[model samples]
Target: MGQRVAYYRRRRGYSQAVLSGLVGRSEEWLSQIERGARDIDRLSTILEVAKALRIVPQRLLPGPFHTTPRQTQQSGTIGTAPDVVPDIETAMLRYDGIAGLVGITDPGPVNLGHLERQVELSFVCSQTEQWSRMAPLVPGMIADSYHASRQAVTDAEKRRAKTLEALVYRVTSGMLDRLGEPRLPWVAAERSMAAAEMTEDPLLIAGGAWRLAVVLRHSGRLTESTDVPTAAADALRRDDRNATPEHLSVYGSLMLKGAVGAASVNDHSAVRDYLSEVERTAERLGSDRNDFWFAFGPTNVSIHRVWLALELGDPSQAIDLADAVPLDQLPPELAERRVSHLITVAWAYYLRRRYREALDALTEARMAAPEQLIFTGRVHTMLSGMLRRERRSIKHDLRELSEFVGVAG
Candidate 1:
């Protein structure tokens, strides 16, 4: 305990009295922490002190020392390692803290450190929160995969290792783009391309490129993003079967991206056309046997369906689809997914001038996933539209939402 406190304190160059003062504790209490006399299980207090020290809260927690951590479960299978789950669980908590910070849930460096710690802790675990916890680290994962390619001990190892990296990149990028941060997705794209090149895997490359394109489109570079999915679909079309798990995921993700992008621009025709492609892609992906990673199961399919419905100006359908998510098999994973889905539902309501309902849905979204301001834009758009439509105003609530996201209404 003493060692942990002293370690972070020195790393941040904070004196004992300074940290004590920051946390509103006595230097004597802080001394007890550094001398191993304190239990340190009182993480809230320790975290408070660590925040004052401007160090990641994780730096103060016991690491994998006492626990015999487990290796990752084999691919395409459920991983039931208890020790590994702790780090994963801790990462989720961290991600929640950071997301709250990003949404202006708290406006202090302490909260900022919480977000960084979440990202850092995620790397220490094989699986973080399925979406929010893992998405932010896509760029670094690509970089690591690149390094691993060079370290491949055998030819078979090379393909397997690099392919795994590409898959990670796609999963993270897919989720990130939907979560409203295209810039980070682009970084994942570059990494995906490099990994694909090293392994000579076109599907992997297309997946990454597709994600980058989606990012570009969402970032207001619609034409450029449109090209990505077009090229990826073209690349897949040339292959033996455009239905491989890799190809299916890439195709499905791109289709979803395009659908959402077109909807954003109020292009109903394009949205309908893309929605057709989405159904076809889902059908094709159904034949793939992989369950753990790229399952693209009913729950996942429903998630996207809700998003598409929201985009097509159908709030009721979106809510119905989102509510169909089966949470029994994967609660944590569903927690994040459910949060994202609710945001779309809220937006659909917001679009229809249903302020109270939209607010209700948005509140649920925040409760489900505190890592991102999932409904920020849609809420603002709805509020503005309502103001004009009814000649009534809800700027007070808009300001509240904006403050949470560290933005202005």
Candidate 2:
């Protein structure tokens, strides 16, 4: 990675100082990075360097991301998806966008209400980390929701159906992202945004933007991800004078997404600004709430602080922040968030070389949401990293975790 950075810097005719200044780093830091004496710990920092060098982030990425790792390799591609992913992908691609124009045939009269209920149920299942129950229903939901959206008999029903379709697409995008199947999640996010637009609902549209931002960040479109959600957040602010709880919920959630994106690119100012705004928004909302399944509130804001701290390469700060979070107060529907926080804690522990604590946190996360573990890329990557540097005392437990997350030990 250092060698690639040095090569690109020279190719661009950038002196070390110029490149370092561009990324807000000192000349010595840049020199050390180029000499392989210092590591760029955060992907965001790498992205900043890549942008300064005017190359795709992948060009600066190490080989592990490009190919499967052999034994003892610390980094690499997130492995394959489960069998269910292909079926979900097929359902997503099979829709021709002419479904509304063509109408439904086999399913008889489209039950928009029933379809809405089922979509809501699927979201609940997903939020609660019930992957096995949610996974099988998704393909059908996508197909049927499209049909219902196109076949709506009235403006009210049309809005309702379109909203359902948008939510379904959001769910699908999230599932694909969690499963580490990248490309289709973008498609699903795009479809979600389109479906949301048809409804002309600000909240739903904002929700779509949030989903797209998440997918964009995961795909390494870090800057665009932040811009997307920030735009949505601005739109919401402009359109509402007296924001309701739902409005604030979605707004705060967008701010949170923007904060994460900003952190990913090492934009410290942007991250601080976004977090400050979100903290204020969370305070206005008074407590934790799951409006539109965002799970945005005070607790969620603190959770983001921990995550953003970690993203900024401050493992100690992240661990300190994690200690103060009120995890026991998390709603049962927010099992997904709880699991994610646990993983973040595990990451913090791992970074601090507290191997036993990391393993214990990961174990707690898996125990909290076992089915969700297989779909998460972090679990696989971290397990592989731990396996590469395993201590004899925890070797057996670590291997067990690697097996659980399907990483070869």
Candidate 3:
């Protein structure tokens, strides 16, 4: 381990003092680390060293260690979707490996058409919350797309391959975010943005920007989160005439995301402006369409209305708006969104002191997307809040639901 640390430090031209200062460790501590005299067992420290060296943490380990499938099944709290934990770990490892991004020996003339279909399938898997099904497919897809891009003889073919790679990374970022793994999602989002730039496609770049904003929002950088989507929306608005349905869908989704960030910070005016813009865009689009897998349009816009209202402390209005929407009409591919909406509805009901209705909504959310509801912080918060209402009597069903979701009864 010490030798590996020394090797990476030298490879990056980082002296002990420089690397130590960057990671906020003493030079002596770093020296001890590099000399095998210090035993570094903390995952956080290992990750920090890897970040300083501009490499994956696994790179510093003696040999690559992977969590077995059985181990993932046993480690329930690590991710809400336990079935996808192994796949998420595998995909992260592949992202860490240089070989996955740039294949050796040209991959011998891959077919871009076949690769495109695989990428589409992966996107569907991600959207539908089919984590167990999607987990085994992503790492190979990323490698194949990279290989295809490298071996392409024409600019068009190369661009197509890179675009597919960008989409794959976008899906990867979404899955990692769902698992609540912070740093890996940022890595995937950045990779998606880089590949999108390589393609020089505005729509794809907007998609990347959307992913980055989501990562920022998840990381609680609310101001930067709002800024990223706001800038992307501005760029998209400038190219409206030539914009396809996909472009408008991405643009509208960005507007909604910016509103989410704005609402988080109590910027009511910004939230209203962004939501209004999305409403206009949705009106232009005419209906809900899952363009670029975003599921953006009128129905989605309404859903975000509920989300924003709840964030802004108007739970009654949120419930009213949520009731006005035809949530059942949402496409089956949008299971995660439906789950989120149901949870939001439950939260609103809880706020109104309607415990039975809240329990029913929460139960429906679990039925719609068990993994998502289990993993969602909002659901846990709502349930815990309900449980803590000492004056109100909690029902047996609510108690069961709370226990099922691993909340205190």
Candidate 4:
């Protein structure tokens, strides 16, 4: 561990003093860390060091030390390896049809109806926050969809197959992102865009762009995230035929993504413009609706406003907006969305030093989606920090949360 730290530090052109200062440690302490004389054992310190070095925590750790555990067959237990992530990566990268062509495997007959149903189930599982059920389904979905696209005979069949494949990849990317597997999600997003382009449907293409833009935003490519979706939304607007609710939902969702990306970079002006566009679309739609699983509607728009306020450092505004947004009113299919909003609300409370409210919100989120909550890196980090700073009055409750989220108190 020390040697790896030393290597990355030097590679990043950061001297011992600079690196030590960055992590709030002394030069000698950093040297000891780099020379095997001392150990950096705490998860928070490891995270700090990794952040200063601009690398993942896994890179600094010796073995498979993912901060978030992937779901295993067992309902509540955490696993060490996060095996499902690697399996999904292998399945997506292998493109199993090649093995079938080489006589190593059999690519079965294409079944568009079955594939479509499976895709729908995956989306439902994701939205409902069933990580255990949804994750195990992804590898088979990816491999089977790829094989189906290959075996498709007619042009129409091929397009249908490709659309299913793209949707599968898009959902897979989102799941992987939530699982804290950084690189594989980008691969899935790229595959989604590539598959969508082959179908020549602008709506499908825009959906792909939306997925890619979201992944980019999470990956910290804020400029490209905002620009890509903005361009796609503009193209959709120029064509009068693309103004259907389905297309408009996707367009509005893209604008939401742009708003998030803009807020992340502190571009308040861009955020307002993008949000105005989203509001216009939401007003046209009349009420909350989930078209194309984009979940673009007035309630969804309000949720984004809370997130945007939080991102822009206005915790008071975020909390106020969150209070008005009735997450319980959201349909069962939007469970993930609801829990995610709860997390943002918790963050707002945390920022305002209202630890009890933050803990209550997180507790509510855990009750709704324990597996998903445990796998969120931001939640883990926040809980860890809370454990460090929480008052003695709330120490027991905060510690319980720390344990639940797999963070050391």
Q: Write one digit per residue (lDDT tens) for candidate 1, span 1-409.
A: 5677787788888899887888898889889767744333232455566667776554554332121212223222111222233343334333322544644232222222333344344432222223333534544443344344445678887786677666655555554444444244565556556666677877667656765775675444555666677667666666636356666776666666666666655677887787787777767666422233333444556677777666555667876776676644444534545566666677766655576777677666655444334223444444434343432355565556444433333
Q: Each candidate's TM vs. the true structure?
A: 0.52, 0.82, 0.75, 0.83
Cα lDDT computed for each candidate against the true fold = 0.54, 0.81, 0.76, 0.80
lDDT over C-alpha atoms for residue 92 of model 4: 77
Residue 236 lDDT (model 3): 91
Model 1 lDDT, full chain set:
0.54
Q: Runs in model 1 with CA error above 4 Å? A: 1-146, 157-161, 164-185, 239-249, 284-306, 312-332, 374-409
Candidate 3 colliding pairs, count: 0
Clashing pairs in 2: 64-76, 100-150
Model 3: CA > 4 A from native: 1-97, 100-111, 387-394
In model 1, where is the ten-residue run with the lowest total lDDT?
74-83
| Tens-digit lDDT string for candidate 4 (1-409) | 7889999999999999999999999999998777655555344467678889999766874432254554444355443325577888778767743565555464668667887888999899778677666777788888788788878889998999999989999999888877767588788898999999999999889989998997776665667988999899898889746478887788899889889888876789989998998999989877788877888888899999999998887889999998788776688778888889999888888767788898899988877777667777667646865775768888888887787677886
Q: How far out, in Å, is residue 266 in model 1?
A: 4.2
Of models 1 and 2, which has the larger TM-score? 2
Model 1: per-residue Cα lDDT at residue 173: 51
Instruction: Look at candidate 3 and give me any clashing residue pairs.
Output: none
Full-model lDDT, candidate 2 = 0.81
Off by over 4 Å in 2: 1-41, 45-81, 98-106
User: Lowest summed-lDDT stretch of 10 residues in model 3?
Assistant: 63-72
Candidate No. with top lDDT? 2
Writing each residue's lDDT as its tens digit, candidate 2 over 316-362 gives 99999998999988987798999899988888888788889989998
